[model samples]
Target: MREISLAEMPGLLGQEVGVSDWITVDQTMIDLFADATQDHQFIHVDPVRAAESPFGGTIAHGFLTLSLLSAMNFESIPKIREQTVGINYGFDRIRFVSPVRSGSRVRGRFTLADCRFRGAGMLMTTYDVAVEIENERKPALTASWITIVQFDPKDRPEGV
Candidate 1:
């Protein structure tokens, strides 16, 4: 991940930050996600049954795709030089625009949308994120993702 000073945060707003490496969403991953979430609908876990559905085959759960943003962010977003940790604040808007079929690959494209000081030691950032499916025109999902970065005031850069 790239490292940046607090003073540089403002300049990144509305700029594309980074794109994550592609990740395969195969049957095993789909099955594991289903087991973890208890969402065993045929379209997500049963290939034979799902093959007859409108999707034509098993597809990943929307929540499963949404949850992937954490890993994607870690791999793509820049790190604040003074930040000690970052935590998910929640999403503002989320849309599952396309289904992720089994064995498909997906990656995240992130743009810094907004940033503000939430408190003395906390910074709130909003990112416009899209999960693109490999070789597909439409993205699997899009969202306004928010996160909070916690840092010590003493470590903050001058004029930040």
Candidate 2:
């Protein structure tokens, strides 16, 4: 993970970060997510019944793919230099492009899309993350994530 100062990130407005290693979305993973989130939809839990559904098998919940973000960011996480705090500023456009069926592999490709100055010394940045399926043309998920990094807590920007 390359560390770049908020100021230096301006030139990286459209650079794609390296892709994360593949992660399997198996029945157990979906089941665990279902249990954790208390979303016991039959299409996500019962494989036999799911096999008869339009999805053709148990499918991972859309939120499950979204939930993988923390892991993706943490594992080999990139650090923004010259910033004291990096806050998750939320996403803009989010789309579940395709289903992540049980036993499928997925990974993320992050692209630094935009950067802007905010209050004091804070910098706002946007990342376009594509959750790609193994050997597939269609992505499993597409999300635009916003982040705010400040040189000091006092430099934090006001809410939008």
Candidate 3:
């Protein structure tokens, strides 16, 4: 991950920040996610049954795809030099644009959409993110993700 000063964050608004390495959405992953979420719908876990559906085969759950953003963010988003901790603040919006078929690959593209000081030692940042399916025109999902970063007051950068 890239490291940047607090002063440089504002300059990144509306700009693409990073793209993550591709992650394969194979049957094992889909099955594991289904087990974890207890979503045993045929389209997500039963390959034979799903093969008869419009999707033609099993697909990863939308939430499973969404959950991957954490790993993606860690791989791609920049680190604030003064940040001591970062927390997920949840999404303002999310859309599952398309289904991700089993054995497909996906990656995340992130853009810095907003950044603001939330408190003396905390910053609120929002990112517009998309999970792109390999070789597919439409993304698996798109979301507006918010996160909070905290740092020691004494470590804050000069000039806001």
Best-fitting candidate, scored by lDDT? 3
Model 3 C-alpha lDDT per residue in residues 61-95, reported as the tens digit of each score: 99999999999999998888999999999999999
Ranking by lDDT: 3, 1, 2
Off by over 4 Å in 2: 153-160
Worst 10 residues of 2 by lDDT: 151-160
- What lDDT does each candidate get? 0.92, 0.82, 0.94
| Model 1: ten consecutive residues of lowest lDDT | 151-160
Say which prediction, candidate 2 or candidate 3, comes out ahead on TM-score. 3
TM-score for each predicted model, relative to the true structure: 0.96, 0.87, 0.97
Q: How much is 24 displaced in model 3, in angstroms?
A: 0.2
What tens digits encode model 1's per-residue C-alpha lDDT throughout 1-160?
Answer: 6899787898899999989999999999999999998999999999999999999999999999999999999998888898999999999999999999999999999999999976678889999999999999999999999999899977665665
In candidate 1, which residue ranges exceed 4 Å CA deviation? 157-160
Largest TM-score belongs to which candidate? 3
> What RMSD does model 3 have?
0.9
What C-alpha lDDT, on a 0 to 100 scale, does residue 74 get in candidate 2? 51
lDDT by residue for model 2 (99-152), tens? 999999999888888888876777888889999989889999999999887786
Two-way lDDT contest, 2 vs 3, winner:
3
Error of 1 at 21 (Å): 0.4
